[model samples]
Target: MASDAPADSVPALPDPVSRARLVDAVRFDRDGLVACIAQQHDTGEVLMMAWMNRTALEETLATGRVTYWSRSRAALWRKGETSGQVQRLIDLRLDCDGDTLLALVDQTGVACHTGRRSCFYRAMRGDALVALTEPEADPAELYGR
Candidate 1:
């Protein structure tokens, strides 16, 4: 996996031919977005899930960094732009239906906005919701508002 860096630190953009083939295979939703799940490439641990528009998907494929479409902000969101938890893309996979994406990445830090290693920190232990892990970093510091 490549080194993790800030959103601004994009490596050389990928070859346009390959990138175009990938972007064309995706079946975006009505909102022009696709569900993308980030997972640790080495550990196979699921990290987080986010939405990606064509721009974000193109950027990520070209730069080798995970990028997402922020629905609330209605803008492209480069991972680790505000928080220092960048995810460097090692590989990306499209579902059979091309409606979902799986990003194999090298995670720099916590993946959750709540400062946990993964967004899936909660579980239904029996009939009750439970938190399986503790926050590894402070939420306040993670966002660095």
Candidate 2:
């Protein structure tokens, strides 16, 4: 006898919660933003860290494109909007306390505005900061300077 479930039927994905629900789940900072850390899904490399407001988190979930709140610009920043380094969301994970978020993404190009693969290219060695990796592409070429 065949099973009742259809072969082509995909498992029901959890429905997205409302903005109010999300707000309740996450504990935002005094500025009403949470720290979102982006990591390369396949390589397990940390790409960068950014801040996200309620709207940015909602938009990211709805659009599958990483959106961040730019503290410097005081506005929503869509990844790859200016540069070609887009981040496609693979998964989103909330921390135990729900104060932080981890975004697993497929990075298209360099994740750093400095044209590096990751923003964390500096390491502490012998009480001195050491550069881990060099820029893959020139910032001028990537940003059209």
Candidate 3:
């Protein structure tokens, strides 16, 4: 049986042809959710991981922006709506098994709630991981400003 993946972990992107095949079909398993990885289009840096239901997936493809089902809010959220840190979709990829997705995006600003450029701002040091930087912008400022 497949194990539960670590939070925010992403399996590497597959090759173009193989990825294309999976994306075209886009079949999800019984859970009604698909694992999605947000990746920086130019540098290939992974930004975050989120879940996408069918509606979120379709909206993302149609709108050319990265969208995800916000489990916390229980609603569909287009990235950067509040923070103006939009991620424009460049391409979409799917895993070999077609159960997961990768969104290649042109990210404008922070992709993490903590205001890091990527969600993976922590680095593994000898026995522990440490945060590398402070948030560039304030999260409260994003609410209305």
Candidate 4:
């Protein structure tokens, strides 16, 4: 979820001590990335799931915007950079195991790359996969052909 505020004006993060503690609490996978579940802060809707490395988590904390490490691109990706469907971080939570992350965010637009509200738009019914919703916008239109 995104805010109307400018991206550069995000609030300052906690001090170094607190930041260090927070970072140290997380346990990354072999690839140094944790699975992050993004949910809509206000609606409590699960938007999407992504991977976040230490750098991505730190950047998100500092910027109040969600960032992820793109496995395909092998680099950091700030949400909404291309599709204008930004996610503004509201809160970050760590599971008891410290192996996963939950990010409460204010989503500005559709969360799915396919231009759907969410990536989990399909459901299994009687051993058949059924689409629960149609794309709100065309992917080609949103991301360019």
TM values, all candidates: 0.89, 0.84, 0.77, 0.89
Per-residue lDDT, model 4, residue 33, is 95
* Model 4 lDDT tens row, 20-129: 68878999999999999999988989999999999998878877779999999999988888787889888888999999999988887799998998898999989999
Instruction: Write the residue-wise lDDT of candidate 3 on 1-145 in tens digits.
Output: 0111121222232344543454457777676778899999889898999988878877666556677889889899878877778777777877788888888877776888877788888888898888877888777775563
Top candidate, metric lDDT: 1
- The 10-residue segment of model 3 with minimum total lDDT is 1-10
The local lDDT score (0 to 100) that residue 122 gets in candidate 1 is 91
Clash pairs, model 3 backbone: none
> What's the ranking of the predictions by lDDT, best on top?
1, 4, 2, 3
Which should have the higher lDDT, number 1 or number 2?
1
| Each candidate: RMSD | 3.4, 8.0, 9.9, 2.6
Off by over 4 Å in 3: 1-24
lDDT (Cα) of model 4: 0.85
Candidate 2: clashing pairs of residues: none
Q: After superposing candidate 4, which stretches have Cα over 4 Å from the reference?
A: 1-4, 7-12
Q: Which residue pairs overlap in candidate 1's backbone?
A: none
TM-score-best of 1 and 2: 1
* Candidate 1: Cα lDDT at 14: 52
